[model samples]
Target: MNAPYADPSVTAKTVSARISPIGGLDVLSRNEVARLRGASGSGLHALLRRCALAVLTSGNISDDPRAILEQYPDFDIQVLQQDRGMKIELSNAPAQAFVDGQIIRGINELLVAVVRDIVYVSTQLEQIGFDLDASAALTQSVFEILRNARILKPQVDPNLVVCWGGHSISREEYDYTKLVGYQLGLRGLDICTGCGPGAMKGPMKGATISHAKQRRRHNRYIGITEPGIIAAESPNPIVNHLVIMPDIEKRLEAFVRLGHGIIVFPGGVGTAEEILYLLGILLHPDNASTPFPLIFTGPRQSAAYFEQIDRFLRLSLGDEVARHYQIVVDNPETVARMMIKGLEKVRHNRLDTKDAFFFNWALQIPLEFQQPFRPTHEAMRALQIYHERPRHELAADLRRAFSGIVAGNVKEEGIQAIEQHGPFAIDGDADIMRALDKLLQAFVDQHRMKLPGGTAYVPCYRVLSA
Candidate 1:
């Protein structure tokens, strides 16, 4: 894969290479080239540059948003409109992305995805008629984006499993995720993840060997990421299919809608946010009968992690919420067996309900889940995390709170906001706030909030439990 490794001794190195497309990114309009070449702040040129850099430094892990840019300050990319389709001209680009004056095949394919998605989103979407306000419209837009990316397949069985976990995790936990992934792969299930390091990358890595052993030719390693989080968690090397959604909300939606089942490994705030988001939607009365298989798993040593997670969920959402997921700790085979068994029910449900196998249209995702929640300071403080509302509603706001922490922890804008206005103030009912604080503290103690060996995490939000 020629994935970039962040060598601490790597002072500075750059490469200039003209890359031709390997995927379906053959042609680009004159306007598209101008858009990529344009220096205007309002144009797509800046976005292309940032995303291209991310692709070039795929496995070079760093939570510091500006670390990569600081390392290769002069990195640049341009789209040249050529007679033979199009060519990408790189200047002062990261040297690791290239080997012997040629870009890596996997990296180049991802680069093509970066170009393809950004351009398609620019031309086809920008006020092209997607009513983002309506839930159905938002879902339709997600559908369109996936369709354009060729993510949607017809007449396929339900086997794609969405694995969720933190980029920052322990070695044992990471290895455990791979074992579970390998087990699933042996049973012919493909993998999808947030597409970054740690748990996200481990499963795909393990599955590749199993798929090879089983002679599975068309195994898909899909990575779903958003621009805001991509800087912190760049797409891992194993991802053959990458889709960058417009926002985190859309990205989360893509995960739930696309996968037949989901497996959650031990993780931190971001993982908590994903858990809450899916649980909130599934708790909806309309989705009560949906046969979505959800599992929480990890190694034997990580048992306490799941215990804490289960306690938090029960405390926050109640005993009924536990029905939506099973806790399968330390047994990778059982986890796989349960998911495969559950998938059979999912297949039966989809067939009985007359729903498509590729996308889960039958699941009723409310407008609250679809709508984007910008984690501004005021928004954080304004979240109604108390128990006076419906469980699902509280879950939604709780998800937002954790999401805000994720932003502060890694996303550039979130970090900037914290530096400017101090930590976000989160006030809620006394018990809820305390429970929240406890869970967050556990994440910090376990080094789940950020990748271990980096800077110590400071509190990004003050929990006002009074």
Candidate 2:
């Protein structure tokens, strides 16, 4: 049940209650429960608290990583062990997550997901000694996580389309995403995204309506995210299947490995990071024959946005990079149709290669792409962005550059670092730096750097052009 905020110290509405696991997790061992309840330095409680709070406060529209925590300081969650399995107790939880004293079913499921992933990653992966440092093992880790979550369906066809875009976007751009999603859903295609608001939510929202109209049953709206990103951008309501990977690298790998194709919407640095990450993988000599479909689309009014992205990409990765993706403007049906055709190619390729429909085992991802990038000030400054390097390698560093900016902009650790030390200093080739500056400046001008309700966006990085 919901309750009024009685504590003068606390400002947001809250409710205190005990909720049982709905779906995501059913039971936990005594040892697992102890780790979850442990509040010490090595314990999982802090991580659980952050992720669970994000799930409880889902649909909150704030990019500030600490907004929810600050607003509800008293909020706490604990996994209570019982002979009947386990029960979750919440103290001063978000009131919006409940209705008439019962937790919102969807929020409960997501909350359970937060716990499940935290426990699984801590107990299973780490205990199993998965060599996260190696590329193949990292891929195996991702596969195991997805399989544990029961997201990888064996009988399904190659119809999952991974949509990459920003949570901060224009109204028109957001609407365009919905339209494209509706078209995709009508054609029996599902969607997977970062699971935040704006572009992430729009596609899933549109797909729901179309799925209902077509009487589509068991349609999947998968949202894959990591701990750092989830803290800033909470999962949207439309996501029925939520999987929180260990980090952003695993999250990105989850997208490419699980989905059949990808669609890019107009977005800021985070979206750029995704684009470069994918293009880097596709550009690899080993993956040239892989038939992964990638398309960039937006409203007619936002054509210039995609044009800027196209220019920056060509300038940074060379014109040959354009062969990996197509830019389709203002046409939702065409995007869906093209995506359908692309999935056909993916299906045929998988059949010939004898690969599983749920996971793209045939695609080769480099170790550089799999490794976790800390995005520290030193790391950002040390990136080699000159044209002297191989194009794929250059793309990897470029992706890291944008990732650091994203961390500084919304992630708690990145923001703290940026506040303690000034903006990250990024210097590369003169031409690349200039283009990067122009693209970032355009993002700032368009108010695509952060959500509108937050404080004005101060750039988190400086482009040092030669």
Candidate 3:
């Protein structure tokens, strides 16, 4: 499955022009522009370049983040302050981002998002003294990021569906996601996702047809991603609203907090990490009764994929962990129907509990889940994954383990770490380790871990039996 348009000879084309901001971002202070253009270590230029490139090359199929940079090595972006507003200038940008010498409207909007989030997180959060390390403080940061992006609508009902799945997935699985999205869209539900391709793109693609058919105005297709993973899994073209969180932890928190419900399609380690993250939070005593609908679904061919996932979850987290989620096989209509009913319950529960519909204020995410887990060699080995700890706590560690694997698999930093330090070693209870090893092996065997036509995926971590 080589990218249909891949050609090393297709060198990047340089474009230098000033473009006005779209949406709410119209102005930036001179200090902000300096920070964006600053070459110092603290500058936002590098971050801006990576994210802007990702949005410009929205439909790129490569999982290697470095590939894009290498292809467009001369690419650069800068923020220019003007009397009326701010303008963004691109150098050596991808030609695909434009049509007839003008940038596409969607790409322009996404580019603005790239600048907005980077500036806000770097300046406002730091200046306001937000404690990103504390759990409550971190959740507040996530909320503020979403609110600033105008993603949190006060009057909107609980209709935002967060779709999670692998960027690399079978065509059948992708099609199945579109079907589910169609059904969800027909019911007037908006979509949110990690904002990559495959399953993430499927539902949005499906929903657009339904949205058009229903003549639905102002439909939202939101995409949330972090800096580390965004380059590898670039934003899909359909995402109308895009927000880049500072890190993976905050990105995951943003999804669960902002989305009314979650629909998981077939995915690899990253998807497993997401499932564990949510289940960990839901299993916490405070969230036990919360009505957050969780569904794992795919086409009939993907039944075994979910089965393996179910087995792994039950084995490591215990059988009761199954109670938190439902599995729907090959039934797009039922999946959508069930989600509508689930969202209805969520709406009622929010009303009863006095929680905000746009954000799940009542869900309690422990500090362990919110704190960033840097996958250094020592940190990966120190994770406590035994039966003695609380179920939710163990789930957090398990989630971290998968998160590290995801980093090693596709993320640029993770790949560099593996290249320099070797594979990460994950140690846990013997039975749990074995189950984890088996599950990961399945992902590798099925080619779920990398792009469909890429070279063989080398293991990035080892599971040690206790």
Candidate 4:
């Protein structure tokens, strides 16, 4: 017997490259650069190195977070201070990021984004008196991160559509995402996503074609990612504006806060986690009257997949959960039409409420949904998944449950913990556990838990019997 073949490890390639920053990220102070280069143990340099490697490996197919690190074990990045501006020095980088000894333009820009956001968040946002524990303060932190990244447009209409789905998806489902994106682009709407592959990449790819056909200029293909997931799911090539939030909670907040509407395609646990997060917020009493368009869409073949999702939501969160989102299957045109109508409603809602189009300030996100969820074995086992609590509260815990499973599946820390302590134990109400087990098993049966054509996926969790 032979071991499975892993991706070829990245041999150290040294390169000293000077490139101009894109999209208003050209200037930085000496203090920021020094912090970026701080020692691996005490400073942001390790985070910066891992994230920079992920950006440089954009468009990669692997889902293992440590795959890049193992390949480029010696790879390191430095922020070189120059008289005029700044430069990046790469010692032992992935050769794929370069072509004939010159770095690819898009990859270079994304690498710069990794540095820019890491520095800004570590020095300015964290050092400032921003409170991550409070809802309003957390939302303010999200706004500051976006404003610093230059993604917010003050005068633009409600057009940025945030696409959410699994990075691991089928061929048919991936194509459906592009078709929906094409329709949205034809209507002149920009796009935002988790900034990885599969459904996340599909809409941007589709919209680019439509934008080209319409000859529309200044289209925004924005991507929002976090540190833990970026290493496994590298940024896709189509993202013109890339922003790295500090954690999964802030990353999700950035999406809802920045986009006018949301489109969800077929996906696995990660997608389910996203759906629950949005529903939990929308189900809040304070947010009952707010209007934000959310649609679950896929090709005709995925009708069953969406049906399973619908059943799980109705069963776990109650039947009324259907009110917050719509399910449209097999009709890209209709999906686009309904989204346009929904966007109009969103526009009028913003106008009537005096909210900004670039960011949704009125949406009330509870502190539970705003705080970062660390998915440890104890955390996974401690989740209260019964229906005795408020529906919104139940939804929040359920969201955390799936979020833990997601971490165990691909996140570096989660994977290592699982390796050391065995699979995470998830104890909940018997019926709820049954529903969750069924849904997750279905994901495995359909090969949604891991990237296609890779190694078979073993369960990362144990559902405790009632």
Candidate 5:
């Protein structure tokens, strides 16, 4: 069979097919099915179409969120309620997701995850009217979503290592991520990432081979993501478990709660945001004694990248923040070894505190960290990046600042806001702002702001010198 059409701009082919539910979704009620098919302003149909298309085009390398939609303009999806279960009808979907007229098995499972998460969040979570204002409630909501997806295993030991890095990175840096992941897998450690390409994909790709050699059965490659960024960063093919949170805050929280430790690789503003989020939570007086292992590493050539990140963190949050994490360069074995030792401490801490291995209940995440931040111009400008405030509070606002830049860089809503209101305006103390400007400029100069082959990179936020 031939594709119905191939767009010259995207140079991609499309197909249409009906697939049975594979992984998470069982049997949705008729009302649930209708809500998924709904087309109203509040309906989930549009969200479903965009996400389902993203899943079908898994392993796509483009960073532009709208590229897939533009390529498959006529793509649509519908959920049909049947006696036994449900069926998904995909129209004008990406041809790569199918082979010889049948959808790829992995892709099929991911598509089911997309549906399962959407329905669970909208109908079950939202309909219950969760009090988003309360910190505990929000965390519980994240736990419920993950538990519903069967991502949280009570019997499993703490082996999941959450890897964070840029989707756009140099070949050398990417290979380094794989080497680190391969070492971790040889030690029987599992991998969890943001589920995109570049650094996110590299680790999982490398770990698969080592896992095969170790004969590690039921090895978990978890990909945790949110709705806003999934289209831009599709789930990499190696991800065996996929869980989608409702928003970025929850998404970050899910990572900290689920993974035993974290590995930081070379990345852009998004990576900085993750660093700040974790450090801020750890710096809180209540969590000061909690041992969460965090390491920043890259290839030998990328030493300066981590140096700039270290400078920015010290200048903005204070030199004391350095105590929270370590920096290791050009050593994959040492990185894995350190992470394994760190996990041992994490295990002992969990035991002493009586915390569940599946979840980190002892960590105190302030409301500021858990709350969803909307990166509108006004909100971005109003952030208080000052030195007088407490270190953790200052870290929270700084995290939001980088988070806004991330929104402007790749998120759809942030891009639209930037187009309408120009670059976001960030103001702070002169020294901190200067350090931030230099760091972001380095990202631009090194092509960390956007993936290669896109248009010339442009600044999305202006650092107003104080």
Candidate 6:
């Protein structure tokens, strides 16, 4: 069947269908179902529609969240509460998610995930039943969210390798991520990512091939994302287990708590934000004894990008921070071997501390890293990024700065804010300002700030001369 309505602006075919629950998302409370079917205002229904559309349109190349919405303006979703279970109704949905009038099973499961996460977070979490004050409470909230999604495995060992990188990247960089992931998979490791395209998808794709070669069953390909990012960077098709966190801060924390190790690839400000957040948490004296493997690797041609990143880290956080990470360029096997060795260390540490293997209960994440950072104009201007503050504290604020830039580049609300008020104004110590400006300019020059297509890139934040 053809699309119900044609928009000259978007010629892509669309379809409408009703799908039953997949992966046990059929069970929902009546109140939850009502909220999902609420009026199309700022209620839970609106969030459900946006997230469900994002799942239906997985693998879309555009980074602008509004771009997809504009392409299929009439797309909508509704949840029907039945006597036995639930049903999802899609109107003007992306045709890509369907094959021969039937929704792809994986897409169906992800669509159910969209409904499950949105309803649970909006209804249960927003009611403040989970205390958000102390650091312990925040961490518990993250654990509960993952548990509700059925992601945390108590019996599993620490072998989930979280891959972090930008969705917008060069072909070489993306292929390199796959190579690293292939090596990791051959070593019997699972994969986790932000669940978007580019680097996030490459690793999982490579692992699928490797897992097939090894005849590995039940290989987990997990994708963790938040509402703000899913529409722009929809879950990559390779993700078998998808979890949508409440916010970016919780999403980042989830990555740290669940994964045994992390591999960084060529990326833009979002990747930078993740690195800063991780390093900041590790820098705390309480977490210094923990064993978390971190490796930065890319194609040989992308070595220069790592060099600049290493320089920025050294300058901003001091040379001692270098002790925490290893940079291995163009060596996927070596990266995997090092990860294996590091996981051994982590296993030993967990055993020594009597900590759970599934979650990093021993790692100390300060409140600075747990709290959400909204990238408002005022928040951006007020950040203090100088040497006067403790190194970890400074890293936390710097992570927020990069996070704001990420919001401006892709998220819908941030994009609109950038249009209303010019680029965010960021002024700090002169040395740090220069470093930040140089790093951001490199991203723009390399087409890392946005996907490589359509219009020219625009600066989202200004680095003033301090």
How would you encode candidate 2's per-residue C-alpha lDDT over 1-466 as one tens digit per residue? 2223345554447787777788767788888888899844566898899999999889988899898899888888899887876789888888899887788998988988888888899989988898778888999999999999989999988999999999999899999999999999999999999999999999998899899999999999999999998988999998999999999999999999999999999999999999999999999999999999999999998899999999999999999999999999999999999999999999999999999999999999999999999988999999999999999999999999999999999999999999999999999999999999999999999988998876788999999973
Best by TM-score: 2
Leading candidate by lDDT: 2
Error of 5 at 97 (Å): 0.2
Q: How would you encode candidate 1's per-residue C-alpha lDDT over 341-437 as one tens digit per residue?
A: 9999999999999999999999999899889888999999999987788999989999999999999999889999999999999988898888889
The 0-to-1 C-alpha lDDT of every candidate, in the order given, reads: 0.88, 0.91, 0.90, 0.87, 0.90, 0.89
Residue 285 Cα positional deviation in candidate 5, in Å, after optimal superposition: 0.6
Better of 2 and 5 by lDDT: 2
Give the 10-residue window scoring lowest on summed lDDT in candidate 6.
Answer: 1-10
Give me the displacement of residue 156 in model 1, in angstroms: 1.4
Candidate 4 lDDT over 1-466, as tens digits, reads 1011223443335343445454456767877877788843446999999999999888998889998899877877888777766777776677677776677878877887888789888878867888667789999999999998888899988999999998988899989899999999999989999999999999999999999999999999999999999999999999988999999999999989998889999999999999999999999999999998999989989999999999999998889989888999899999999999999999999999999999999999999998888998888888988879898899899899889988998899999999999998988788888989999999999988998787779889998863
Candidate 6 lDDT by residue in tens digits, 208-263: 99999999999999999998999899998999999999899999999999999999
- TM-score of every model versus the real structure: 0.96, 0.97, 0.96, 0.95, 0.97, 0.96
Candidate 3: misplaced stretches above 4 Å?
1-14, 39-41
Q: Model 4 lDDT vs. the true structure?
A: 0.87
Which pairs clash (backbone N, Cα, C closer than 3 Å) in model 2? 1-101
Cα TM-score of candidate 5: 0.97
Each prediction's RMSD over C-alphas, in Å, is 3.1, 1.9, 3.9, 4.8, 2.5, 2.5
Taking the tens digit of each residue's C-alpha lDDT, what string does model 5 give over 100-197?
87888888889889999999998899777889999999989988999999998887778999999999999999999999999999999999999999
